[model samples]
Target: MDAIDPVVGFFGLGLVAGMLRSDLKLSSGLYDTLTIYLLIAIGLKGGFELASRDVTALMLPTIVIVAASAVTPMVAYQVLLRLGRLPHPDAASISAHYGSVSVVTFAVGASYLGRQGLDYDGYMSVFLVFLEFPALTGR
Candidate 1:
């Protein structure tokens, strides 16, 4: 093949690798447990830093963050559809996932913010969960 189609090649290679694997698989049970642990760790770490900050100053930014987080996906979906030629539902779904930043990103960002003497609202942590789960279950 002169040019490998990335999406097809990814799954093709994955299927071959799975068939060839010996004992490197992690069971679904363990993967779920790891995910839960990771989420809790991020929440705890964020909560601790949030507790350290002055709560009074973050109220407005917290509201702003939540609104921006929700609305950004719609904007992204339009861009992807018009510029990238993705279909409507596909673009919207993917845009939602990307717009909702993940915990690891949040965790690293929160750490940076704290180190830089900036205070962020803790409820943004809750908003992250809301953003990801609904999009997932809706599909």
Candidate 2:
């Protein structure tokens, strides 16, 4: 019944399965199907909520999200290159990976917030799409 129970349970199950050398594995097609299902479900849910709201209301937050997405890669790339002493190409690759948002992480966080009875802007799904592009192209 805890907010993070599902997250903890799933993580623990994976850890236990791995440690036990279980043969549990998802087929590639099933994996892709699940991924696509999740993406479309989130997009449709977000879009439905978004449709009820005014675009101008989300503009400022969208701008901030996009700006952060753009800045994160630059900062990561610099840190990796200078502090980590990584080569240019390696640093850039790592930065791109770091800059992109993890959909699974976002889904878990959203679920946690919902379980805790907290309110978050539904437009966040739209923001996720916006955040991905800058990080990918920034490098």
lDDT for each candidate structure: 0.68, 0.83
User: Quick one: best lDDT, which candidate?
Assistant: 2
What residue pairs are clashing in model 1?
none
**In model 2, where do residues sit more than 4 Å from their true spots?**
1-12, 15-24, 135-139
- Put down candidate 1 lDDT per residue, 19-65, tens digits, no spaces: 98836556999978966876897677557767877767766766676
Residues 1-139, candidate 2, lDDT per residue (tens digit)? 4354665456568779999999888899997996898789778878988999998988998889888888888999999999999999999999888788977777777777877799998768888888897855642
Q: Estimate each model's TM-score.
A: 0.56, 0.80
Residue-pair clashes, model 2: 0
